[model samples]
Target chain A: MRVTVNGDPRDVPADCTVATVVAEAGVAPDERGVAVAVDGDVVPRSRWAATPLNPEARVEVLRATAGG
Target chain B: MLDPRPDDLVIAGVPLTSRLLLGSGGFTRLDRFERALEASGSELVTVALRRVEQAPGGLYDAIERGGARVLPNTAGCYTAREAVQTARLAREAFGTDWLKLEVIGDRRTLLPDAVELLRAAEELVADGFVVLPYTTDDAVLARRLEDVGCAAVMPLGSPIGSGLGLRNPHAIALLRDAVSVPVILDAGIGTASDAALAMELGCDAVLCATAISRAREPERMATAVRLAVEAGRLARGAGRIPRLDHAQASTSDAGIPDLTPAP
Candidate 1:
């Protein structure tokens, strides 16, 4: 299935959770400074692991490590 | 109880995950400032404007590296006109309408002049700026500023750089109840506990510099402050139980009261 990741469309395996998408996108599990939002709603850190990603989900990840 | 979430504290509709706001000054190096910002979990950071004499230094880049929304402060202006002009300059330089308006009346104490502050806030609000004035903890002045369309009113806990914490919480509470805008406790925070106390008094946020930058370990202290603000905000939401005049304890019932027992 195709999902938009951080504003760029990318193909991922169907029925993947947010944690699986994040891991597949080459982001380390312990990475800091990345905030994930799905359909304009921020996914809290606690719920990220269990949030299932739909096939056409739009995900935006903001990293505050670079702007003030 | 769960901590107060990001939706609890907001400034002008901007959601802030951390109740602690950082000031981008007093750091020896940009890297240190970056570390401190990350550790502080501050979503809003303040930067002072300077005249572009020779060239724009790396401070802007450093601030960008820290990744927080920048709030440019008008630190040294004395009059309403001067502050308005400085706000324009800051807008042109920083490309943001959000301003931390500081209109000083006296050179000795450097306190904000209530009259000039309201005057500046009125003009700035008219000019389509989000004015956040740093002023004394006066309920009247706070109400006036709010009436003038200020986005927020930042009352100093004490004198700037004093690190004395909230000197007049009663006045702060009055302002909190009077104004509709966010009441941010700015300046005079000495330690993590100080920031926590400010939050416990129902402040929207606390802005500080020396307490974080001047500490022995800025990063660690930044984390401490972040946790402190969260703890205090939770406490405020949880509603502390009142104390009683005398001590009391739960007791077991005696056998003499078993009139109809074992029937």
Candidate 2:
């Protein structure tokens, strides 16, 4: 199966869930302020592990950034 | 016969208990911003997004811990298309329709471009986004924005990040009367007194960043602004008693005879 993380397309195992996709990206679970969106809808942190990934899924993870 | 206490200031169905709106930028650090936000008692705070690197850890944990409604802003965009697209991206990231629309026209002053502001506001409102345009202190422009379905119109007290304080109270007051929607006095606030003055002039809320974030004691200033906003709101609610020029003597024909020793 294939999934896109943060606009970079990559191939991952078929059993991967959204949490697995992020874990593959190397972000630790204890890290804070990270939000994930799949297909333009936010996948709340609590549900990330349970939500399965799709082959054509487009996921974007954003952290709080600085601005004026 | 009497009105109930004013309802919670709701923007796009988000309940904001605090009238003082704080920005999530320009702090000494994220922890500083978080502490200042807590001190201010602000229920709605602004965060910005750019096409830049994402931090290793998430950036929104502290803000979420502050227990405020997260309102992402398009502060860096200069065009309608970019602002609109950013708004959509924010909705996707935060899963909230609330947005702080900022369309800057010039870099020197960071003033809002009224033309692009209206364009972006109209587009966002049509697409089911709760658009809050950071605008100028123009009454005519404010009316036009309300007509376009803006949830709130934020007119600057002065240029962004200037902190020069309320430059034109009359114009802000005019904007207040001219629009039926919430009129937020955005930017140019330097101190707690400034925030109080804006609310006294009938602004529904005040949005400021540098005033508190750059202060010598950021958290202290934040608490001051919070009290100032509340004092102003209470004063407005109490209504000002008109002044009288001449003093009138009190009279009671049946009383005060004893003061003359029955003479």
Candidate 3:
């Protein structure tokens, strides 16, 4: 399936879950600071495993950063 | 209400002893950031959310180690919808609903879009977030933000990172008087005096980032800002002497001794 991860178009498995996409996006499984949003809706950490991404989904994997 | 123990900076029912909030940006290194954070004595600090690829790692852990409440900001988001999405991501990233809402209308000035800001505030408040928006010095807009259920109104001193100090003290003062919530002087603070001036103008607190993090010595600057905040708060309560157009001597004319050289 084709998906947009962090604004970059990529090819991933058809059955990719939120957790899998997040992991593939360079966020280690032990990293708790990362969060995901697919198609503008946040996928809570608890449901990362259950939630599946659709083709052409806009997936955003973000983490806390420094700013004023 | 921040002099005695009972007096604290209470926002959204969370009491903070330190009113000087710091932003985790522009530090040279992690140790310097930690030292500055320790010196700042900021109970609540601001952080930004960015894509994992673009963001530097370990800021969250550093802030956590210092025990400051994480206030995630929508800094780069220009529209209401984008800000709302960023806010949601921030909530999950930081595990805190306290948001420093910034919907910028311009790139150079970095001023908040009052229309979009109000819209976002209404939505976030309804979504159970304690929204503290970074707004202009306009009192009417501040009131509108308050009306939209924002926990507090943070009026800018000047533009973000401008370090220009309070551009319109009157507007800031007017906004302070116009709103019932805490008035935090956010941005464009060049030094301790600016922070002091902000507090003297009746601001509940001051938010400084570049002034501290970019200083030659970040830790010392933090301490300086901390002292400035305290002094400003004290001076505000102490009641400053009225400004006089003419000068007045501390000593009486009658007490003046005789004679200069025989004029």
Candidate 4:
């Protein structure tokens, strides 16, 4: 299946979950301060492994940065 | 120094002693940001959300170590939908509903789109977020934001990072008087005097970043802003004398010797 991760399109294996996609994106499993949202809805960390991604789903992985 | 009135600044039921809200941006290094944050004595600090790869390493940790509560902002969003989505993402990332809502209307001025801002504020408020909107210094708009159940209304003194100071003191004062929620003077503060002026004009607090972070000595500027805020608050409470066209002599004419030449 094809999915867009952080505005970049990529092909992932079938039945890929958010956790797998995150891991494939080089984000360590223990990485702190990261939040993931699928199709504009937040996916809690506990549900990442169970939440399946649809084809062409927009996954936004965000973290806090310095700002005003 | 006089202690700030206990429970004076209550935003969304969170009591804060410091009227200066610092922004954790523009600092060249984490150590300096830490020093500036410590010196500012701000209990509430603002942070922004971005892509994971763009996240500043150790910035959140430093903010935590400084012992201030974080108020994540949707700074770069340009629409109601984008702002709402960003707020949710920020809430998820920070584990807090406190948001500094910003929906930019234009690229050049970086002004808030009042229409989109109100739309986003209404949605966020309905979603149980403590919305503190960054709005223009317009009294009616401030009231409209308060009507949508915003925790506070943050009016810009001028454009962001302009360092032009309070461009419309009357408008800020009007908003301060018109809204029941806290009126925080956000952005366009150039120096300590600007912060002081904002406070003196009846603002509950002043939020700033570039003024301090971009200064040659950020830590020192932070201290100055803190003191200036305190002084301004005290002065406001003290009730300044009314302005007059003519000067009034401080010395008593009767006590002075008659050394002047006879008329």
Candidate 3 docking band: high
**Per-residue lDDT tens digits of candidate 1, residues B12-38?**
666667778898767766777889989
> What are the lDDT scores of the predictions, listed in order?
0.77, 0.82, 0.91, 0.91
Can you write out model 3's per-residue Cα lDDT over B1-263, one digit (the tens) per residue?
34445758889878899989998867758789889999999988888888988887888888889988788999999999999999998888778889999999999899999999999999999999999999999999999999989999999999999899998999998999999999999999999999999999999999999999999999999999999999999999999999999999877888777777966
Interface RMSDs of the predictions, in order, are 13.1, 4.1, 1.3, 1.6
Tens-place lDDT digits, model 2, residues B1-263: 22334656766655677888988667747777888989999878888764224442334667778888778889878999878877877776677788999999999999998999999999999999998899999999999999999999999998888888899999998989999888888989989899998999998888878888889989999999999999988887788867689865567556555555654
**lDDT value for model 3:** 0.91
Model 3 chain A: ten consecutive residues of lowest lDDT: A25-34
lDDT of 2 at A7: 81
lDDT of 2 at B204: 85
As for model 2, its CA RMSD to the true structure in angstroms is 6.8
DockQ each candidate and list the results: 0.01, 0.25, 0.80, 0.72
Model 1, CA-based lDDT: 0.77
Q: Residue B138: error of model 3 in Å?
A: 0.3
Off by over 4 Å in 3: B1-4, B255-263
What is residue B101's positional error in candidate 1, in angstroms?
A: 0.7
Q: Residue B156 lDDT in model 1?
A: 89
How far residue B141's Cα lies from its native spot in candidate 3, in Å, is 0.7
If the candidates were sorted by their lDDT against the true structure, best first, what order would they fall in?
Answer: 3, 4, 2, 1
Docking class of 4: medium
Model 2 achieves a DockQ score of 0.25
Q: Is candidate 2 or candidate 3 better by DockQ?
A: 3
Candidate 2 chain B TM?
0.88
